[model samples]
Target chain A: MNRKLISDQDLVNLYVSGQESALEELVGRHKSKIYTSIYLLVKDSYLAEDIFQDTFIKVINTLKAGKYNEEGKFLPWVLRIAHNLVIDHFRKEKRTPIVTNTDGFDIFEVLGFVEESIEDKMLREQGHNELRRLIQLLPEEQKEVLIMRHYGDLSFKEIADLTNVSINTALGRMRYALNNLRKMMNQKEYSYRQAM
Target chain B: MVQTFTQNDIIKALYHELPASEMVHLEEQLENDTEIQNNFEDLNVLKLKLDSLVLEPSMSVISSILDYSRSYKK
Candidate 1:
């Protein structure tokens, strides 16, 4: 069976019916978006990994218990699960996300290996890290909208519903997020030119 | 009827979330509107940059999840 031809709902059904690889395909298809969403929210690779695992654990339990009900919306559903897990974590810790590097763990260090030239890898890493920093700087509401729309691939309606805001509010937040990122990127470029 | 488009509408168009009829209007407006064109171009570039920023967890984490799935069969 062509995996691409199968829908997320089908994959969920297959997994529920005892096809193990179906779950693999589903997770593999969404791991990047899911992980990055969590990482951006928590801003720590270790905590992100923990929450990612817990998110899947909840997914597996829910599916195994025959409780999967969000038809044709697996990604959004899983993203919601991960988002809740991140919230639970923060609630337990009793603090908002902090940008800390004292753990000596580089979030990028845990990226899955890929074949690329050293120069290409360095350039890609630099650009991605820079973007990540800018994303981290966004105000919480704007950042959440940006991540859900851009990475989670959630539609504005879905985002509004998930975030308890109106669709226009979600769109407005996204607009702000992109504009803020653009300003920061341009400022960085200007600073680099000045230094050179 | 003349329809006005907001930056938010352009964003919805960027994400393909606009209604088809509104998309047609937005496209038509884009042909004559430099301001909207510039905003769209800037947002599109940033969106592309964002799309390329995919990050993945390590193989070990994936393995752990997979192994748990296998051993904890429903």
Candidate 2:
């Protein structure tokens, strides 16, 4: 069947009705967003992986028990689960999560790289690494809204509801996030030229 | 140029979430207003860059998730 044409709700229904591949399709369709959202928040690959698995485990159980009721809203629902799991981990660790690469873990280690020449690959990787670090420099609230809207594919209204802020507040956070990222990129380019 | 639009409105329109009525007027103003056009262009560039920053978990992690789902197959 043409799974790409299938809606998330249809995929969920198929998976619940004994089609295992449907579940795989669902995960494949959203793994990047789901995993990246988790990773960006926790800033740890191992913890992110664990929370991702746990999030899906909950999704599996909920689906099997016939309680998967968030029709037409699968990705955001899963994101909320992953978001709560990240929060739970932080609460248990008794430490606030910071948006710095203090641990210096290379997230690209687990990230997928596209086909490119050796030189091209290095340049792309460097670019991606720099952008990822810039994202880490954003404030936590701005980072959260950016990740939800950009990576989680949630609308501003959905983000506002999830983050318990007004839609305008969510939009403001996203604006700040993008503006900050743009400023950082420009500053980096300027410094590069100055050094050259 | 008849209505005042905020940066947030440009962002909303960029993400395709601005209401249709406002979008019609926003498009009109985008053609006439240089400042709004520039703001929209800058934000759009940033948005495109962000969109390219997708990352996926390792295959092992995906396998574990699939296995957990199969184990509880009803």
Candidate 3:
């Protein structure tokens, strides 16, 4: 706690110096973002939480084995570890578990036209839930790029390298992702455009 | 609808991938181009919607991870 002003790398150094609480601080700093990133991808809270645990476990093991050389950017590294684990889980299951076309993502479908008089708080929550569902409806690659760039907080270059694609391809995926989401929004007014 | 920058160009602009002059040009053009402006809004809204949905794992999850990591070894 005395080293509150130090960087993640410094925390790592502290942990390396037999201060177990340093690891706790590092995990505390990153747990929310990291958890949300995995949850968005996996779409199953339980599995995402499991992967979250496994990710930090991997981090702990690697660091204990004296392998984490990156300083100051622990979250990205933690995210990379989580991302790969999610990919691996899907591959082993022989299907992308997160891809679903269910109507569960829509407000009208879920809550059936709430009165305009409803509290703004509840309305906002529903709106967020709807958007979250819509995100789940995106195609696998697009959704991956969206989550990595937006939630995982990686740049397109990092996303490109992580997915083994060209930078243009990564950027293109993001572009199409935005387009698809807009079309999904206008689904009632116009048919969705097929991606090229 | 006017076509100003390509979709990739708009993306680059939105995500700050464009260089300074290109970004300035895109902004200037978007000011006069409704089509490009709409496209920018679409992309911006998508990013906003996704960014707004912050999912937190439960406290039980936090406890489990903490316990696991503490006991975990190389």
Candidate 4:
């Protein structure tokens, strides 16, 4: 069977029907995104790695025990597990200020390696840095919406459902986030133009 | 009447969270309003830049996860 042709739902069904390989394939498909999401919250590579594994273990137990219902999308279900684990990790450690930029995990530097065009790449690098700085400045609500919507590729409706806010509230936060970014960009540009 | 939409309205339209009727109205406005069009483009660029910021987890993290998954059956 062409693994590429296998939809998430099909793979999930296969796993539920007792095919081990199907479970493996599903994990292969989604592990990075899940791990990255958790890591973003926890900000510790070793701890993130451990929680990533635990997430899969929990998924396996849930699926094998026949307790897994395909209520929402599979990815979000997996992500919610990871999110809960990160939250638990924080509770256990009593860590304040989840996700600090103290280490060298500058989002801009990581993204800089992925761009192709020279000028576009440079602009993207600059944009990445500026965006990161701007995101750090946003209030927590707006920041969470931006991360969940953009990084998680979650629909606004899904985000609202996850965050337990109204759909309009989720949309409003994203709006506020963008408007804030635009304002910051204009201010920065004006300052730069004046400097030149 | 050339009623002006605010930045928030443009953001809502960009995300496709607007109602169908309002979406059509916004699209029509975007066709003629350069400022709105510019804002749309900037929002788009910002979204792409943000999307590109996502980093894949290291290969070792993936391997550990697979190993951990396999251990569940043992």
How do the candidates score on chain B by TM-score? 0.92, 0.89, 0.70, 0.71
Q: Write the per-residue lDDT of candidate 4 for residues B1-74, one digit (tens) a residue.
A: 65667666776677666688788878898899888788799899877666666555566655765565556562
Q: For each of the candidates, give the backbone clash count.
A: 0, 0, 0, 0
Candidate 4 chain A least-lDDT 10 residues: A103-112
Tell me which of candidates 2 and 3 scores higher on TM-score. 2
Q: After superposition, which runs of candidate 2 have C-alpha atoms over 4 Å from their true positions? A: A99-115
Residue-by-residue lDDT tens digits, candidate 3, A1-196:
5666879898998887767888878877777678878877877666777898889878888888889887777888889999999989988999866454342232222222346555865777767776777778888899889888877778788899999999899999998888888887788235425432
**Residue A76 in model 1: shift from native, Å?**
0.5
Q: Sorted by DockQ, highest first, which candidate order results?
A: 2, 1, 4, 3
Q: CAPRI verdict on model 3?
A: acceptable
Arrange candidates by lDDT, descending.
1, 2, 3, 4
- DockQ (model 3, Cα): 0.42
Candidate 3 vs candidate 4, TM-score winner: 3
Model 2 chain A — which ten-residue stretch has the worst lDDT?
Answer: A102-111
Candidate scoring better on DockQ of 2 and 3: 2
Question: Any runs in candidate 3 off by more than 4 Å, and if so which?
Answer: A1-5, A98-118, A188-196, B1-5, B69-74
State iRMS for model 4.
3.9
Query: Tens digit of lDDT per residue, candidate 3, span B1-74?
Result: 43357778888777777889778778889898898798788778777666667666666766776676567665
Residues B1-74 of candidate 1 have per-residue lDDT tens digits of 88998888988999999999999988898889988888899889999899887778877888898889889854
Cα shift from native, residue A129, model 4 (Å): 4.6
Q: Please give the lDDT score for candidate 4.
A: 0.72
Q: Which has the better lDDT: candidate 3, or candidate 4?
A: 3
Sort candidate 1 into its docking category.
medium
